[model samples]
Target: MKLQQRLIRLSVGVLLLGLILHVALLLGYEQLTYRDRALQDLRGRAQILALNSAAALAFNDTRAATENLQTLRTAPAVVLGCLYAEEATLLAHYSPSGARCPKRPQPAQGAGSIRHVESVMVQDQSVGQLLLEERLPTLAERLPRYGLLLLSVIAAEAVLILVLVVALRRRVLIPVHDLAELAARVTERRDYSQRVSTHGSDEIAALGMAVNRMLCAIEEREAAIKENAHLLQALIDHAPAAITMKTMDGRYLLANQQFAEQLGVSTEAVIGLQDIDLFPTPIAQARDQADRAAAQAEGSLRVEEQLGERVWLSERFPLRNAASEIYAVSAIATDITEQRATQASLAQALANLTQLNETLEARVAQRTFELKQAMDQLVQSEKLAALGSLVAGIAHELNTPVGMVVTTSSTMSERARELKAMVEGGSISRSKLTEFLEDLGAGMSLIENNSLRAGRLINDFKQVAVDQTSMRRRQFDLGALIDDTLHALVPLFKHSGQRIESSIGPQIACDSYPGAIEQIVTNLIQNALLHGLAGRKDGLIELGAHVSHGTVQLTLRDDGKGIETQYLPHIFDPFFTTQLGAGGSGLGLYICHNLARGILGGKIEASNHPLGGATFVLTFPAVAPQRASDAS
Candidate 1:
């Protein structure tokens, strides 16, 4: 709505607000006065009745008291009334509605009703009490009359307001409408020199004068702006780069001479034209996409364009008005065909250099492959060396017991020969016989112990050698297997003065490849001996195995120096070792890791123990996973 209409509505709203407040005040005042008048009238009537009943109450005349209350018939609002003696005994009562009065009611005070208690006195002494009640008129009963009066007044005022509105619209709105029409003409024609005429000395007339002065100032500014725009156009026309301004819908608003030349059109002809009107469909579509992207972006965009066998690098950016809204897209383009050609030549040179570098890399890769092959050969050799060590240990262990048994057999045969010679001469005595039997018993005991020791060695070596060679799956006691592997590994430690603590927990049965477990254990123990011992001869290697919840845990700890921090993470990587040449082929722990995880379905971790040494933990399921075979 126009300001004129708003002002008229505001004036009428103010009048209605004031009228509403006045009506509220009237109603509030009437309610309070009504309550007071009702109470006063009722109190006066009750007091008169009290005065008249004094004689009856003093003589204890119930008949006279009843007649005095009967006088209340004229006041129908008095619903119930009662006369009481000094001791609160009822003397008489009256009710226009035939309702009984309450024997004991709290004294109430409110606008809803009026209850008056007046005392009867005889000769300055209390004789009786007169209670009167009256219901006051409610607001509902009087609202219709007040409403009628309010309507009549409102109608009269509305008529007056309507006349005043007509006068204001003519006096103020007419001039405002004329000024608005003048502004519209100036804006439509883009002419700031237009001005509204003034007639009176009022605010509307003064507004017209101010607008005239503003128009004069704007007209001067507009002249300066036009000069600046012409200068800018001349500058762009002479610029080396092609420059143009396009609206959001792709129509050209300003095209410099350079841009017009590129489009094969005069500058005047290029105005209001679009890319689609000048270029082919493909080129036009590409340009439109780039322009739209730039207009939507928060900043400028750089893109390449192909136009008539020439490549141009364009910087496209949004053109925003004073309100920071993008109204068009402006682009500046420069041909870069020669520059791009030079870049292409340089790129080819880089490609040739890259090929030469790749050739050198291939030679280096070949050398690395030869070295890796040597390392792999050492790995195979180390496996053989390990098995040879096991055989050597077994031989050394059985030698001692075999020698003991052979020596005892030879000594016992010599003793038997001496006994036979004595018995043949018939000179054998009881003492000699007894000595022979005792010597025989001692020799038998020595042979028995040696035989048992040899048997155990052979049996353990047999089981381990078969398992390691066959690499087959089977169920066995893990604790016992560990003990056997350790036994075979005894020679590695025995001569080195390293002590081993073996804690093989009970009931550790496993359904897995014993050979893999054996290989992993052997590697860990050997790795510990070689690296973890750190050249300490008396290092302690603790090997433990236990089972719980169908899983087995095997841990190997060494009292040697812990693994070097820099080499810890790569310890289990193939061909990664600090020893490299000194007893470590760099594959011991790597092989152990592979066997434990790949064949035994277990996880292995290596860490430096807090106390001292490197710790390797291997955990595996007791029942190994059934693996798919190759080519399956």
Candidate 2:
């Protein structure tokens, strides 16, 4: 603020603070002194009255006590008084204001009112009590007087300060304001030649001289700055790179001659123009994206782009202000079309030579790779063929039960037809009808059994095939499933003088891929009958299951000529079967091994028992690994 204003504010603030404190002290002192004197005066009057009323109270003279209390009228401030007899009876009371005497309660000692209670005694014996109450004067009742006095004092102080402020405004403030005005002019016009007038020999005049000297220095520095800026602008315009400044939204703020020429426009036309207005849609979009990327990155970004026949390598960096915040993007684009063309020519020459040398080697390597891929495809095809053969065997097995069901059902229909004819001809007999129903019941039972057999076979084949194909995990009753599979293979051993004995528990359960286990069992059984018991009679194949250590142990042994000692090690190898000439395909054991290790996530081994038998044991996790839904 101006000197005069600051002086006035300082004076007024000091006066207001002093006045507030003075008024508070005066109010406090008046209340304290007034309350103390009023209390003492009331207590003295109460004591005197108490002494005088002691005689009246002793005699129980109500008239004398009343007369004694009536003297309280002389003290108009006493609102009420009371006299009590020796037995606490009210003998006399007085109220100068015509208000009834308040009940003689305990004296309430506080600032607002004076309550004095003195005991009345005669002959050193308690007689009566006298109470006097007087309301003290409140500050509010004398506010006008104190307020007027405080105002008078503040007014006198304010007048004196005003006179001093006026003098300072003329002697000091005017000169300081002159210096300030000169500084303001220098700042506004940027012409720092003006000097403040030195009107007096004082500190303020000296300050005026200092300000004029500062302006001189500033003027010289500004000239140097202007010259440097001119040189910098010239260098920027002459630079080979096409430099431009643009907002994040792609609007050009400034552009050099080279940048304008690259866009085939003048600098004036380039400024305020967006990329889309100067370039094709694709190029414009690319440029805009680069600008936005630089802004979002809050740092520098580089982009290499092909525009028409030229290649431009542009480096865009964020332009920050005094606050170190990115406000715009500055891009310097260099044309690299000629350089790229030269490099392309060199590359073409080298590629021609390299192609001649690498053609044969590349072809050879590619053929090798192709042949390896073909072999892998062949192996996969063989696996799929084996799976197809298993499906075909299952289909063949299903045909028998389905054919039996069809044949039995047809026979039952014929029997029904015959019975209907006999009834229509009225030649039906009781014995004949009974025999017919019995046949019908047998036929129904046959159909149900066959249908169920077909269903079970289909279900088993489905689960096995699904697990083999996809390796899906599920919970299954191991014993029951094994029994069902054995039953399904009953026809194979029915007339072969062979027995398949199972020593599996009824409650053995597993949470794994049952289909994989089924496949393994089927292959092992076929392998045993085909290899170990090719020509033997009374062949016995034993299968057993037990659970331990979180794994299911399945053991299958055959009582026949055991596997050859030399071939025992390769027993589970693919295409290593001795009966390969008899259409063994050599994949059964290999598939079993893979299913156990990969699908069922387990292991299997083969050994020759000392008792002339080949035994195969497979162990697998009771709980299979979780199935990946997206597994191919």
Candidate 3:
């Protein structure tokens, strides 16, 4: 900008000087041309005067010559005119109306006026001389016009100069100044992004382009440096170990994300903080000593640091400056708390294992005895569960009969009381006596029938417990025994919306454990009632028995929802029940399986009937496998 200002001042001064010289030269040339025109006119007039005066001089007519010279009065500024004889004498002279005329050729002091001399000849003889003086106007008279003209010229040149100066400033000075400013800014601020727009093929433009190239190189280097810094920071932040760098005095200079997290603070907060600011005094002192030692040694030092419940394998190292002097210390910490705990746990577990090995046999024997007791209890529970079902059926079956018997006995007692009252009143008529007798007989019959039904239900249910507890065998008719067992389980289906049907041969008898047979029958019936009959409105339970070859073939089936296909294989598995968490103990079918196979020596298999529903078939020797041990 300063250079541009200097250029403008210098250009203006030179232009003004040139303009002044041009105006002066124009004025001088105009004055010179004016003088020449005046001279030419005066000479022409003098020649004419001399021509006229020649005739006068030849006759010595001075009066006529003077009269001719007076003709100069017709022109302005012809201040003086003279016509003289060639003998160094003035023959005639004329003057303007109020001006003096020079008689001879007077030497002019300057160009303010013009003087010319002429001679006349008559017939090639010198006759006389003619002299004229024309006075030029004074400088004062032309000064205003000159001054106005000069001003006009100067004004035009001023405009031209202004235009040229503006063009130069825009196209040259401004761009140069901008380039200089840009260079200063880039150098001072290290900002290499600014550019100067150079339009023309000039030196300044080339300089701008060179600066742009330099800026490009600088920017590239800056970008590469920033990228490398970012990558280094990223690596430190993502490292698994906690990393930190601190001044030799233990003031933190850098802390990666992991270290910040380990210290339970933000990365920004960790910076500039001494170890004492973040940790307990003892821990901080220990850490600070480690850092100082590492820096003094100019090498790495591995130290184990216990911070609260955590253990860290801290590798403290020194960071050096360009002068190879230790400036800071860095630490990379790997956590080993969990590893140490695991190692201790593994050692303790090995010790416990050795101790257990020494007493394994005794534990096994105790566990075996406990298992035997549990099995016995489980069997007892199963028997109790079957008895529970039997009791439920008996209670249901006996409800109707006991209620009838009570009603009939009450009616009979009421009738006998009425007869006794009539006899005491001595008004018992024959028809009344007959009506009372009839009512009593009908009540007696109802009581007898219902009592017998209740007795039969009780007898059947009582047999259930007897058969389960006593492993007695009998040559009982299979059909009668099944009927009796089915009768016992009748109350279970009475309100269950199921039909219990039986198909048996009358002579089919079994010498097997009746108790086991009873148990198997009760379990199957209970299973059908509880599982197959669940959620069913109407169902059918069919019991079939026969003697085939030397074995008694018994089958029970229900036309209820069958067991699921997936559960069919495990339907009889001990402790596996589809109705788990409900009321089912999962022991009914297992006990049935055990009793049939283990006690009755029978192979009982269950399957889904082709039609639908679950079917169980029991095939046992007609004479049980241990007749002597199970005889009734």
- Please rank every candidate by lDDT, starting with the best: 1, 2, 3
Q: Would you list the clashing residue pairs of candidate 1? A: none
**How many pairs collide in each candidate, listed in order?**
0, 0, 1
Write candidate 2's Cα lDDT for 1-632 as tens digits. Answer: 55435455555554454576577665676666767777877876676567556556755778977887787776667888988764456788888677665555457766667788888754456777888888765778756434533433344466655765676788776875776577446545656567778765555665566556555655565577679878877887899888999986778998988887777878889888899999999988988888888887746787888877777778889998645777789998888665555444434533543443345345334433543453344346644554654453444445545555555555555666676666544345557767766665565565555555555555444344424445446788889878867765654575589899998988777888776687678779888888888888799999998988889899999998888889878876655768757846566777778778867778999998989889999999888766553253
My TM-score estimates for the predictions, one after another, are 0.27, 0.30, 0.31
Candidate 3 residue pairs that clash: 84-91
Can you write out model 3's per-residue Cα lDDT over 398-487, one digit (the tens) per residue? 454555555455544555556555544434455776776566555545555545554444444444452343355567888887777665
Error of 1 at 109 (Å): 99
Off by over 4 Å in 3: 1-172, 187-191, 345-632
Clashes of 1: 0
- Ranking, TM-score, top scorer first: 3, 2, 1
Better-scoring candidate (TM-score), 1 or 2: 2
Error of 1 at 451 (Å): 23
